[model samples]
Target: MRVHVHPDRCIGAGLCVMSAPAVFDQNDDSGLVVLLDDSPAGADADHARKIAEHICPSKAIRITGG
Candidate 1:
């Protein structure tokens, strides 16, 4: 699967990063969504996407190509 986050829609809540530290992170200063893996490997992809969708307050993270 391919995951993408719209930076413009991001609120810098840090929820996505908190939900999946291994898959998501934030910019130190800007605190914006930072995708750790655009094309995640194995089962981590689903998990990452799930957490991203759930944690994102703005719902900026989008998962495609399942």
Candidate 2:
């Protein structure tokens, strides 16, 4: 699976960060969405994708080749 976050659409809700810290984080200055992992692996990978999709209010995060 591949994950990407749209910086322009992110609202800094922090939901994605809270859901999957290993996969998402804050940019500090702008507080926009930051993708920590482009390709997550192992057991936590699926969990990361699910949480990211679920919590993204703007739908900025998308999963491809699912």
Candidate 3:
């Protein structure tokens, strides 16, 4: 799977980081969503990424090529 994040659209909600820390993070200064892994490996990571995508309030996370 491929994951993409739009930091400009992020609201710093941290749901992505909370749900998928392996694939997402927050900037220390901006508290915005940070893309840790564009293509996370393994099933567990993929599942967590999907959850993050679903819960993102600003729809900043996008997944493709699954």
For model 3, state the Cα shift of residue 27 in Å: 0.4
User: Which regions of candidate 1 fall more than 4 Å away from where they truly are?
Assistant: none
lDDT of 3 by residue, 4-49 (tens): 8899999999998888888888999999988878888886466656
How large is the C-alpha RMSD of every model relative to the true structure? Answer: 1.4, 1.2, 1.4
Residues 25-54, model 1: lDDT tens digits:
889989998888888876677677777677
Please give the lDDT score for candidate 1: 0.82
- Candidate 2 lDDT tens digits, 9-59: 999999888877888899999999999888888644776667778778898
lDDT of each: 0.82, 0.83, 0.85
Q: Top TM-score: which candidate number?
A: 3
Order of candidates by TM-score, top first?
3, 2, 1
Better of 2 and 3 by lDDT: 3
- Specify the highest-lDDT model's number: 3
Candidate 3 wrongly placed segments (more than 4 Å): none
Model 3 lDDT at residue 31: 99
lDDT of 3 at 4: 82
Q: What is the lDDT of residue 18 in candidate 2?
A: 81
Candidate 3: C-alpha lDDT: 0.85
